[model samples]
Target: MPVLLTKIEGKGNGIKTVLPNMSDVARSLSRPPTYPTKFFGCELGAQTSFDEKNDRYIVNGAHDAPKLRELLDVFIDKFVLCKACDNPETDLTITKTEEILRDCKACGERTGVDMRHKLTTFIIKNPPKNPKKSKVKKATADGATTPNGDADEDAGGDSDDELTLRIKAEAAELTADAAIAKEDWSADTSPEAVKARMKAVEASMASVSLAPAGGDDDSDEDGDSPFAHLGHWIEENREESAVEIYKKAEEFGIAKKHNTMTIIAQTLFTENVLTEIPKYAPLFAKMVTSEKHQKSLLGGLERLVGVLHPDLTPAIPKILMAFYQTDILEEEVITQWGTHVSKKYVDREISKKVRKASEPFLKWLEEADDSEEED
Candidate 1:
């Protein structure tokens, strides 16, 4: 029940209905503004433009607050509210079966959305950017830790173990107050338990938490030269993994402080990217799980391949293999991405060439599966 503010823009015949605070409302509703704006246009038979970067949504023709509010109510009932819990805290997920599902973040229940609706089509095209999949730990035969590690396959690619994925999805049981009190919060109510609990409480109540013994902070906010300074620091320090570089990026506070992931992407990868992909991919997967990081990672790669070595387009196949091996980028995402010439990082022509170069590898992926089935 958030307030929707409307402003009439342009002169006379060219006027449009502008929702100035649509982004804020969308943020509160845990949805992208474009989804609802498209819904309004579809419902009203009017044209709508979503200027996401500028945080402005304009719908063609004039509309009063009452009319707009009524439209919003229908959208909320259809899209925002979770069908199971009736809670607005839900994520819109497109299942592997291509069904639209409203996953309630609060109640942890998934309700199917009717696919016949006009709004469902738009939601399908624009999947949610928020990637919040839980991280799982795997123990090796010799007691090793791998963060979604790959299993070597016959055709020079890797896949995740089905058992690991299943075991990782242990059912969640919400504990009640009665259950907690009965268990006494620990196995035994002996002196050792009390002492341990007191120690934990004291640690939690400590005045200031200290950093680990050898941890470092790279925060340098001296005007506009933080990244330049970061570049120099990266050159000086030998970061073995992308995960280490990502941690350094966070420590620099650029992701939070500078509001840019470009610097992190640039410094994270080594000069010989193809050779380093295997070494860095495990960590890279973890970093690019977020939308901002994914964009930056893509942009950084675009600059590297598009600007640095445009002629080395053949390497795109093998380079993408590492990402695919680690399960970082999905096939549908890359295929949809290939159809576009994004100018977010490099020149349109260069990005086009990179996408074109990536086609064979993508096709090979599909054909490989089909070939396996035939065999």
Candidate 2:
């Protein structure tokens, strides 16, 4: 017969032949079951079982391990949030899987809250209990069978074999829970590391802002930022403007990659938009390379494309072709050029340019279109 490890006359005794109510056991193990039919609305999944060769319950692929893992993750997240806020103190209760409740523990009022700031005080309401199913484990004839032909009625994990299975299951659950705790700790730690990185970046930006804005020490500041000084010089002097402005922007943090792009983009077009490209090059290039900058890039590109004349775009193919012909550009420049052309061009109009400036870009577009069609 099996036994319960309980206090006997104010002393911790060995296992005694008395089983607690199944309802009391269920209340102690609080996480809800994912599969209603298999678990029967009981929190039995948390119990350990040492059934398989690996000393763990074989939650085989047939049993939907992935879905079960997802449920466990979500349940743990809710449990952590609830524990953080001492949720048992409040009378709030969450009902459905989709419904999230955010009420103040102190005032019992709905308050505007940022979970990031309230990391130590966030509660998720308990999901509604499913009362349609039974929580008790049904006793079977095999479970009641005893040695020497007498009936043995024990509760929880009854036989030695069943107890081993239960222990393995519990051990597996503890291992899984530990893994989840480690992941959560890593994620929480990352925010601190990210804050430090952001601070270092800001420091570098401040240093760049304070640096002298030209290569030549002889160059005069003209009482303003390098850009303003360049504009003034350009208004006074014509042929020297482009080189001087390009030089000035370099010292002010316009990247070398962008400078190359600006030169290529300007070579095939004749519009005043070239001036605007230099002005926004830093923001545009930063957006092009950064995942975080994607939203800003999308909005800026849409606005820029919307205001631009259709005539100005016709020169993109020409510029790309020139890029391909240069041995130095090879594939890197050609790829970026191709991306630029595709971002701004379509099939019918892509062939308008026949010059040395358009050939390479056109060939790339045709091949890309063919590959896409095949796929």
Error of 1 at 343 (Å): 3.5
Candidate 2, which segments miss by more than 4 Å at Cα? 1-238, 241-246, 250-309, 327-333, 336-375
Q: What's the lDDT for residue 69 in model 2?
A: 39
Give the root-mean-square deviation of each candidate in angstroms. 15.8, 29.0
Q: Weakest 10 consecutive residues, lDDT, candidate 2? A: 180-189
Clashes of 1: 0
Candidate 2's TM-score? 0.21
Across 289-365, the per-residue lDDT of candidate 1 in tens digits comes to 33344445555565556654455566776666556545555554555566678875655787888988777666755
- TM-scores, in order shown? 0.42, 0.21
Question: Model 2: per-residue lDDT, tens digit, 247-344?
Answer: 54455544232222222232211244433343323223222222212222222222222222245444444333222221112233334333453322
Clashes of each: 0, 11
TM-score of 1: 0.42
Best by TM-score: 1
